[model samples]
Structure formats: structure tokens, C-alpha cells
Target: MWENKIDINQIVEIRAKTTAFFGVGAIKKMADVAKNLSSRGIKKVIVMTGKSSHIKTGAWAVTKQALEANAIEYLLYSEVTPNPTVEQVDEAAARAKSFGAQAVIAIGGGSPIDAAKSVAILISYPEKNASELYELKFAPDTAVPLVAINLTHGTGTEVDRFAVVSIPAKEYKPAIAYDCIYPLYAIDDPALMTKLPAEQTLYVSVDAINHVVEASTTIVTNPFAILLAKETIRLVAKYLPVAVKEPENLTARYYLLYASLIAGTSFDNGLLHFTHALEHPLSAVKPELAHGLGLSMLLPAVVKEIYPASGEVLAEIFEPILPGFKGTADEADKAFAGIRNWLDGIGVTSSLKDEGFDEYMVDRLVDLAFETPSLDGLLAIAPVKATREAVRNIYTNSL
Candidate 1:
């Protein structure tokens, strides 16, 4: 058994592009965060979040109290939802502009944080709409300051510059990664994550797992990504089941939150490939589908096809679950089988068919994969050539 070495009792300050505080009581730093923002001439701010995660998790009271204590003015935009739409961001940006919000405070998971990033941009440039920003019609060079109070153990938008927004009308879900989008201040308090439902817990950790897997094996793979990916997988393998079984286990939540953060940093440095490229379209079409579940459904098939190109690196990273892995091209089956079994053991056994997809949708998904903006960029980085035939075969095997 692995020993617990992380000191979750002490707040650790992570200084990356985004200054982050992580630990049990990290949310208490909201006062300091507010004061710092206030000192920066940011008197009026916009708080962006999902419908009720902030209130249900008790993060809202603390954050509101902090802003009030600092004598800062704030407006709340609570319409963000899972797979946040471009319209939601545009509306929030318009409201923030009308309120003269000088900065943005995003509280919740990736959906709200991602929306907040786009809102910040639109607030700065009232001339551009969400579509213009997302479609890259205009390259935004600056945005209003952002503070992220992350409430989940996945989707490391807290510390990363990437954000994903969807246009369900057009079935487009693309990602944006700009240096300006990194939050000015961020908090990840696992205490807030204990109430996350079991399925979401599993799905979010799966998202983190996907982050590292793609980060470690991409064409741009590097030592930093490899090291972080190995630890990310190790922590998720050890702690995800425990967190699922014991929902209020702080230690389990602590490590999983750490896993998610480093996983974010890993992919930020090393980039991603097949899984994200394909999963975006799935969730884009089926707005109810969780991003993590979509990625899990496609992972085994992707690993099978891509393993040969980076077998040694992948084998080392997945060694915990895929024991006795030989890191050879011939062991591709073992690599994917081990991953598939591990996913099943973790209660993520859903097939694409179970998610209301069928063979009929395969062709449409394939076209979306190729047509979606920024996805071709992801596919271009696959270690193996991502030909239409290869993409079609992977989707067929997934089904």
C-alpha cells in the first residue's frame, strides 16, 4: 500500500501562471484575494457560476463575505451550465459591461470558469460577440482580471489557460488557450468538493486521468509532462475509488484535487491529441453527456491505436493499473485491455451505445471531428497519422 505523504493540513501556495492556494481551508484566502483585487483598482467585479453549486457547496457565502469585507462592489451571473453555451457567455459579458464590472470572479467547475474567460474578453472588447471571439475572428490581447474559486477535482481551469465553450446550435465545441486567460488568483479547497455526487466524482477524476494520458504521450511529450502524468495517474488510481465510496473523505479529495491540478499543468505544457479531439464532438452533439464520460468511452480505442508510437512512456505511466506491461508494440492489446478493465473497475463501464449513440451516428461524429474548429489541431498532434480511415476505425472500435 502506498503511504499518504501529502500534508493536506497546510495550505500550499502554487505559483504558476496563476497564483493558486490548495488545501482544506484554502477558501479562507478569499479575503486576501479580494483585497488584492481591490488594491488593483478593481472595485466592481462580476461573479460567474453555475445555478447552485456555489451555494450548495457553501463557497458563495465565504466569497460574498470577502468581497463585502473588502468594500468591493460585485454582480452575480449564475446561468452557466454544464457544456456552457456561447450565448450564456455573451449575455454574461453584456451584463458585466452594463454593470461596469472591472474584474471577474468565477466559482464552480470548468463550465463557469470557461465562461468567465470568454466573458472577461468580451467585457474588454464590447465590439466582439462570443462567436467572433470563439471563432478566432479577433485575437484578444487582453482581458479583465479573473479570480477562480474552483469547486471540483477536475477540469483544472483554475491554473490553466485553456477553456472550452460550446455552440450547441452548430454542434461546435472548441477550446481556447491564451496566455491572458489564466486566472489572476485561484483556490482549490477539497472541503468544498466532498459533496460532489459519486458519478460526478468518477467522471471528473476520469477527466483528470484523460488529461495526463494525452499529455504524456502527445507528439510534444516532454519530461515535465511525463513526470506529472505518472503521478496524476498514480493518485487517481489510488484515491478515486476511495473518494467514490466515502464521499466525505477529505484526504481522498485532497489528493484527487492535486492530481487534477498537475494534470492541467501537464497538458498545458505537453498538449493533447485523439481523445479530446473526438470527445468534444460527442459532448457537443449530446449536450447532456459529461465530458469525462465521453473521453472514457473513447480512451481504450485511442490507446490501442496510438500505444505503439509511445509504448514505453505510456507503459511507465499506466504501470499501476497495467501491471507487467512490456512496453512493446505487440502489447497494444494488453495496454488497452488493462485500461478498459481499470475503467470498468472504477464504475465507468458505459459504452458509447449506452450513451444513446449507435453505428448510425458514427459518420456524423466523424464529420464533426474533422469540421470542429481547433479539433484538427488536436488530431494533427497524434503520434500516429490521424487519417479519416484511422479516425473512422477508432470510432467503430469504440462502438
Candidate 2:
């Protein structure tokens, strides 16, 4: 929900320096960028990818191309997991250092890209511990040139300067936000996403939708963000199912990818709210749930919880974007109902219980969530600060 009281500091200064190359077959452009960066005297690139079957579908080809061209010495950290741990990043950083990498290339979904960002920062600031980096308290002056090749339309880790890394030592995961973390180039090619299964595709789209909705509804609202959020919702509602059912549909895949980028840009500026805050701990606790599914389970309930606290602002914002009501109780219900309907349409379960969660774990989950800096960040932006009891209640409702 948007309020007219725009905080000048919250007015994000968007710069247009990063190069975004998008197309149906844009993976081909990766070679061109690699060659160009090589010719421009870049060498020793570190490539971070996941071990998933989906990642292998595209990354192997790209890695082979880079190898054949001998354009740059490459280091491959392919052991990245779904919710990447800090130790994984430390190991990747070690590999980057051993390879004398001057730049970083991330290929896969958010996991690898997020890991790569942390690794890139470690390349320059090798002495800084992962905990320090995750805290966002340490600001590094330099990071390796990073190029992101996105294979999923999810976290928007490719375009955003923020990287979310899970620290097992601490009870929380914090976003490492820095200007240097922004990828030097982003390649969103739909061809790479053709191998994504229906469930994966739908799940990632739900993740992207959360990004849009959370940022769109948060306290520090922007007009551009609202527009992006509306478009993201429309695109997800329409194309997510198409892309899921017909994985080979390049057009749907392309739209999903573009929508993800736009959503990422919006959240990069406005940041996320309670959904992300609540989801992070679930992933940390039950590593199998996956971040997207965690958010999917919590989104609707969190929105309902926050709606009453920010009623007027939300009504004004949703009146035009959400149809079937005149910004009244009916409108708000329709707006949230539309989200639930879409989630159902995409086959996302809205209850954490459906995802194997229960009330018994809520207290521990709440404790872990509060440890997250992003939770605090989101709380600061929330219409109503989520108390321990409030968080427990939300979790209970989600279950």
C-alpha cells in the first residue's frame, strides 16, 4: 500500500549504467560479452552454478564455450545448494582465489548468483569473514566484475545489488547490500529456461510475484514500483501457467524472465517486507521447503495481517490495479482474494501445513526470524511492527 508521505531518503536514485541484454536466444550473447570483456583485458573469471539438473541444461554449454574460446581462465563452483550456506561461499571464494579470478560469472537461479555475489566480495576482501559480509556492516571498496546469467525468473539476483546469504553460525540470514554487488552485465535468455519442469517454473514465478507484491505494499512505496508490481502480477497470472504447462513456449518463458527482472528492480529499490522476513527462517530451518515455497505459503496470510494496519494506503494503491471493488472492504477482500485465486491457479499451496509445517515450530521459527537483519529491516518498513506474538500468530494462521 502506498502513502503520499514519500521519504526523500527512500526516493531511490535509479541509475542506468548496467547493461541488460534480453532476448529469446540471448544465451548466445553470453559468448559475445565474454569475448568483449576478454578483449577489454579481463581475464580469470569465476563461474558459480548449482548442481541441479536444471542448471546443467544451460551451464555446461556456456562453460564449454568459455573453455573453447580460452577467452578467460575460469573457476567453476558448481556445488551451490538451494539455500546456499556461508561455508559454501567461503569455499567458492577459496576456489576463486586459487584460480586468480578477476571477475565472476553466475549462471543458474538465485542460489548460485547470490553465492557468487558473496564470493565476488570475498575475492577482494578475502580477510572479511562470511558473517561480517552477511551482516551488511562492512562496506568493501572493490569487488570483482560480476556477470549474471539468469536461468530462472525468480529472485532477480542478477540485476539487484543485494545478495541474501544464509549463515548457519548465526541464527539468521542477512542481505549483503552494496553497490559493488550489482552485476556488471545481466543476460536473460529464455532458451536457457526451456528445461525447467512445471513445478519449478511455477514456484519461481510465485517467488517473483512475492518480490513485486512485497515491495509494492511496503511503507516506502513508489509509483514506478506500483506499476511494476501490477505488471508482474498480470504477467504471472497469465503466463506462469502457460510457461509451466508448455515449458518449450519461448514467449511465455521470455515474459516470465522479463517480469522477474522488473520485479527484482522494484524490490532492489524498495526492498521486501514480512513475507521475505518470515520465509527466510523457514528455509533456514527446513532446508527442503525452498525459499520460493516458503514465501508462497506465507504471502497471503502476511498480506491479510498487514492490510488492516495500512488500510487507507492499501485501498488507494489497489483501487486501480485490482478489479471488482471500489476501494472498500469488498475491494480489499477482492484484492487479497485475487492473490489467493492466482496462487491456487498456479497450484501454490497457501498454508505452511501443506508444506509440512506446524504450530509446534512457530516459536522457534519466530526466534530465528527475529535474528535476521532483513526481518528488522522489514519490520521498520511494515505498517505495523511484527511482535513475537504477531509473528507466531501469522505462522499459526499460515499453518
Candidate 3:
């Protein structure tokens, strides 16, 4: 029933700026990675992660052992939380700077890895604070090497050069893309992702879906983006439910992880538009909101808005779940219904209202969508113009 099948037992190496080692038991290679870093004169490192997922999944043990075996000094910075803040990045960077960290080992999902990217920048240029770096006060041309140990199949931070951080006081959540922030090494072990909670498994895959959706629809989209977008949708539509139902199913986890990896590459090449631009404000206003959940809540509305402009591409990519969807601009409502049904099928039945938002917040979210730094650039790449009225309508419709 599957096409172009992947062998679950085969470990694969993917080389890019970040040389990724992927498969079950891939975390075991951390010792070799550490030795390589040591050979490059990286003597001291800072290990970044969220509160406990790494430890729970046992990835942390392998990493700690590897560092010790290589005689590398390390500091564990575990205070990273969802919607990582500028303050947290600054604090971690400062600590790493004082400790003389020569590299960073980020051991969790997007949040920790994203934070580590910024921390790496600060480590290289100790004179800059997180705000200066995030605000693009100066373009950083270099950073300490980052080794990403991915624990979730979302965000694709391990492979992409994007990192998002929030400033709650200002209601600003912005992304930074720079060549220097790419990881020097990455590990995507499905074995480590097996223990992820059901909600997170759903949310993360939804995030990957949004990644490819906007990626392929953007004005800068290319053939590579379209190809990866279709495959990402197919893999997630088939395997997300399996992974959510059987969290310990390594095969499901492996394919879902592959979906995210390719989705990352897709967006990195194609760029993104309204969905991400709009979703950042939602998560920025409510720091407790998971980034993927926020994206899920806004996806259908954003897709509905863009379907008219990119109907043919979207209909083709979403056909795995949408079935006989006709690629017609006049059938935009059908496309919207198809996407909403797929979301419902995956246990994402919540909306902005379900998530405690109401009409009063629409104007504020719309304002933030445009006012946030770097978001305007994302909005500019949309197939349709992201006017204030359009942004407001998207928010109200999500509610």
C-alpha cells in the first residue's frame, strides 16, 4: 500500500551544513560526533534542552556519556521552555560565555535548538546581547558550532537556518535566518522520539504540515519545494495517526521524522507566508501556547485565504487526504473543507475560541502580525497580498 518505501532498519547519513545521522540507535553515534568536535579544538560545550523530555527519552544519557568519554567539559542549561524568550537566550548565552563554551549541543525539539542557535551566535560574539542579535542590530558572520539532538519531528530547526524567539513585554515573536546559525551536526533518532506525548506528536506533525503548505505556495517556491511538499503531506497523512495511536511504533516515528526533515528543507528553499506570519502573533501573545498548536489553529483559515491563488498546487499536494479535490479557484470552499476535515481527523478539533481567544483579540493579533519584526517579510511573500483587512479576516475566521 506504500510507494517508494523506506527500509526501517537502515540508518542513513544526510550531509549538508549539518551532517545528520538518522535512524533508530543513531544517538549512539554521539560519541563519535563528540570526538570529531574535540578534534576541531572544541574543548568546552553548553548543553541546551527543555525541562525533561531529553532525560525522559534517554537521549541525554547518551550525550552526557559521549561528552565525558571525549573529555569535553560541559554545562547543562535546562531552563528552555516553549516559546523561548529573549531573556532566556540572553541568560544562557551569558552563562556559556562566562564558562568559555566552544560549542553547543542542543538536545530537544525546536525550542531548545532555536535557543541554542541564538546562544551560539552570542558565544561567538560575546559583545552582543540576545536582543541585539534578534533585532538584527548586526549581521553575525560566524557562530560557535551547534550539534542538534532532535527529540521531535517538527520545526526542522536541526536542518533549517531559522530560529524564532519571543519578547512578551513587547508582544513580539520574530524569526531570524542566518547562515551562521545552521547546526554543524544533527541526530534524528526515531528511538528517541517514541516516548513523545500524544498531543505533542499531533501538534508537531501539524507544524510540519503548515511548513510545507506555505512553503510550496509562496511566490519564491521552486520545483524542489513542490516535490518535498507533496511527499511531506503524504507521509504525515499516512503516518501521523499511526504515531499518535502507537507512540512506541518506530516505523511511524521514522516516517513522521522524515516528513519533518523534508518539510524543513522545503521551507528553507521556498520560504513561507501568511500562516507563519499570522501564527507567530498568536503564540507571542500567549507564551504558553505551543508554536505548532498555534499554527494548527490558524492553518485552515490561512489556507482558505490562499487557495484561490495557489489552488492547483495545493489541491495536488493535499490530494492524499483530500481525495478527488479538483484544482479550481472557484472551489476554494471545497479546499477549505478538505483541510479542516483532515485537521479534525487528526484530533485537532480546537479553534481560536476553543483555545480561549475571542473577537476582542482579533484586532490585536492582526496588528501584531504586521508590527512584529521580520513578519512583514514573511507576509510579503504570500501569493495574495496580506492587507490589514485580510489579516483581520483570517484571525476572525480562525476564531
Regarding lDDT, does 2 or 3 come out ahead? 3
| Model 2: per-residue Cα lDDT over 268-297, one tens digit each | 767788888888888877777678888878
The TM-score, computed over Cα atoms with residue i paired to residue i, of candidate 1 is 0.98
- At residue 228, candidate 2 shows an lDDT of 83
lDDT score for candidate 2 against the true structure: 0.76
C-alpha lDDT score of every prediction, in listed order? 0.92, 0.76, 0.91
Q: State residue 15's C-alpha deviation in candidate 3, in Å.
A: 2.5
Alpha-carbon runs more than 4 Å astray in model 1: 1-5
Models 1 onward score TM values of 0.98, 0.89, 0.98
Q: Write down the lDDT that model 3 would get.
A: 0.91
Which tens-of-lDDT digit does each residue in 48-119 have in candidate 3? Answer: 999999899999999999999999999999999999999999999989988999999999999999999999
Per-residue lDDT tens digits of candidate 1, residues 61-159?
999999999889999999999999999999999999999999999999999999999999888899899887777678888999999999999898899
Model 2 misplaced stretches (Cα beyond 4 Å):
1-17, 52-55, 309-322, 329-338
- Scored by Cα lDDT, where does model 1 land? 0.92
Worst 10 residues of 2 by lDDT: 2-11
